[model samples]
Target: MHSKTYILISFHTAELGNPDIVFLISIVLAFTFIMFLTCEILLQGSLRDHSEPNDEYVIPHGDWFEIVSSPHYLAEIVIYAGLVVASGGTDLTIWLLFGFVVSNLVLAAAETHRWYLQKFESYPKKRLAIIPFAY
Candidate 1:
């Protein structure tokens, strides 16, 4: 992911000619750090509350789990979106990568949501697959 952002930066820099290196580096670093933190927080929250293998399956609660079936997947999409923004938001490749990530995660979240519905009749009817209030 960082590699792809670096490539986009290189392409953008080459086309624009002598863009501010410090500013670009700052943007990249900031986005990378945010992506790392967001993924850690959301994924960790999901995993921490997850049911143990021997335990009966239970729907997770708290954090973004209450809002969507797959908060971890949402984190992934956010990470890619941050990369796209860090890449100056004009690169075709980065946008395509973001689209790919979103599509795959959306599909996965939908499947997870379906599984939850099948497994537990008491699953919240208000919960969405991935996006909050919208799927």
Candidate 2:
């Protein structure tokens, strides 16, 4: 949906003659990619670390897990935000797409966090659902 929204907006706004807008898009894309990669790596590493044979589930630690229960979901939100920025930040469809993505991810993350708390006795109490410091 994010890619489709970006492509649709780009095609519709093909006459974007502002170099600053292009630069902003480029920077946003780069930052989004980096943030996504970092979150994914952290999530993957956490999963791998807990993949050992065990009778009980282990709460993932390290990286953003120290702050949020679902870093991957946060990364997903960041990706959609980047798409919105790349779509020139004024397209109603892109904004709606971003809002949808954010809402769904937040809901999923909140549920995951609740499950974690219920399933594990050592779950971090300070962690938010998805966003750091604020849910």
Candidate 3:
């Protein structure tokens, strides 16, 4: 039901624009969708089924986790930025979109880094928490 609602919303919102705008939006949306799905599939076994309480906890089976921490939140930023870009070049929207992406990336990176440090004291010193290489 939730996924259905998301699809419907995307469809309706995608339609509320000029044909050219819609076409561009469709491309951005497609990119966001494909990237998200690909990431999910690639990290399937590693994803947790339930969200833990808002507290520090040891993540079991480090090998099995889709995101080191909060990839969904990052994806949300990507999705929204794509939408704003697709909606045409709105200065305010672009600024907000970029801000959202940067903020989420920063927060997710920090949280994931801390989790890695605590969850695996011996985690490969070279392995980054979120963005690969020099996060």
Candidate 4:
């Protein structure tokens, strides 16, 4: 009982000395750009019309919207995925965060997909709820 000691906290070391840092940084930056691009596309595609989805409801006709009901959500998952990959996936914390993001987004996307199908008979039949060609 006298030997009880507090656990010491260790800080994550900077990987700037490693060559892999360059590659990892590039990947992270690329995905960050992609995330912003997806957001812009969503804003561009949907914000123009004052009307909510109806019979004439124009779902974003091009790009990711053609593939999934929730491009924004997919983009978010991709962003986190990039972070996980950049961390070399040794960090369980990042993976747990990624899982949380995926679960929440999947649920939202699925609900949105259901609403889209119910509201519009012409909703792209081939499009997936979230993950393309799988979900």
- Using TM-score, give the best candidate's number: 2
CA lDDT of 46 in candidate 2? 86
TM-score of 4: 0.71
RMSD per prediction, one decimal? 6.0, 5.9, 7.5, 9.4
Ranking by lDDT: 2, 1, 4, 3
Stretches of candidate 2 exceeding 4 Å from the true structure:
1-14
Give all TM-scores, in the order shown.
0.68, 0.82, 0.53, 0.71
lDDT of 4 by residue, 1-135 (tens): 333321111112244445466556666869777787877878686656555556655666667788888888888888888888767677999999999999999999999999999999878899999898887
Residues 15-88 of candidate 3 have per-residue lDDT tens digits of 66455666677789899887677557535544453466445554423431333444444555677677677656
Better of 1 and 2 by TM-score: 2
Across 1-135, the per-residue lDDT of candidate 1 in tens digits comes to 999998986886786565695367557767767767866786667666645564565577777888899887887787787787666678999999999999999999999999999999999988999988888
How many residue pairs in model 4 have overlapping backbones? Answer: 0
CA deviation > 4 Å runs, candidate 4: 1-18, 49-58
Candidate 2 residues 55-126, lDDT tens each?
A: 766788888889899998889889999999877788999999899999998999999999998988878899
Q: Which pairs, if any, clash in model 3?
A: 46-64, 46-65, 46-66, 47-66
